[model samples]
Target: MKTYHGSCHCGAVKFRIVSPEITSGVRCNCSICQRKGALMTPHIYSPDDLVIESGEDQLSVYQFGTGVAKHYFCKVCGIYPFHQTMRKAGYYRVNVGCLEGVEPLQLQVEVFDGKRL
Candidate 1:
């Protein structure tokens, strides 16, 4: 597995997660995703592989539809850096933009038919 560092805008929220590879990610064309412009990477880490270094209070959550997915954003900067959804249950969808030292184009993306939900 590989370790990746990431943070929210304004540097308020910082975190790390482990993935088998950096190139795995998903892109959804759902209403909320299209509006938010989120490109998600599946974060399947054990408790030891994930850490939130700061800014817990600055985070906000949004849920809709079946309320199974929890979208997490920075309250200060209004950037949705990650989300927990029913699709992956315990896993998280980490926004690729939040990762440090990585370019969005470097990842391979699979399209999720979230619009049909």
Candidate 2:
């Protein structure tokens, strides 16, 4: 496992996550995810695995439908850093594009059928 640093587009929201070195990602086909088009971590993470380094107050959350998922983004920069999964409420998935040293487009991504959830 490795510790990874991530931040929003404007650096207004910074955080860290401990997970295996990221070699792949997930692309969700849900309505909201389709609009955002962000590549996310392949595995869900527990809250304990994530640490907010700074800008906690600058984070904004958006929810719709059943409101099971909580999409969190930087209020200042409009960049989504992570989100609470709808499949499991307290679990999270980090945005690969937001992580330092990660090239989201280079990742071999799996398509998730989130639209049916």
Candidate 3:
């Protein structure tokens, strides 16, 4: 497992998560995801794997559809760092682009048919 550190574009929010080295990610065609255009971790992570190092107060939450999933972003920069998924309780999916030293565009990506939900 590896610990990845991430932050918002404006550096207002910072966080870390432990996961297997990321080699790929998922892209959702859901309305919100299609609009945001972020690549997310292919696997779900338990809350224990994630730690907000700083700027927790700088974060904001957004929810839609069934309002089960909670999307979190940096209020200052409007960069999405991670989100809690409705698919699995207390589990999260991190934005691959937000991770330091990671090339999100270079990873192999699979499209998720979230639009049908």
Local distance difference test, each candidate: 0.80, 0.94, 0.92
Residues 1-117 of candidate 3: C-alpha lDDT, one tens digit per residue:
999999999998988999999999999999889999999999899989989999999999999889999999899989999999877857999999999978997999999998777
As a TM-score, model 1 comes out at 0.87
lDDT of candidate 2 over 1-117, digit per residue (tens): 999999999998899999999999999999999999999999788999989999999999999999999999898989999999999999999999999988988999999999899
Backbone collision count in every prediction? 0, 0, 0
lDDT digits (tens) for residues 31-92 of candidate 1: 88989987787554544666778987989989998888788899888888888766656557
lDDT of 3 at 25: 94
- Summing lDDT over every window of 10 consecutive residues in candidate 1, give the lowest-scoring window: 41-50
Candidate 1: deviation at residue 78, Å?
1.0
Worst 10 residues of 2 by lDDT: 43-52
Which regions of candidate 3 deviate over 4 angstroms? Answer: none
**Among all candidates shown, the one with the greatest TM-score:** 2
List TM-scores for all candidates, in order: 0.87, 0.97, 0.95
TM-score of candidate 3 relative to the true fold: 0.95
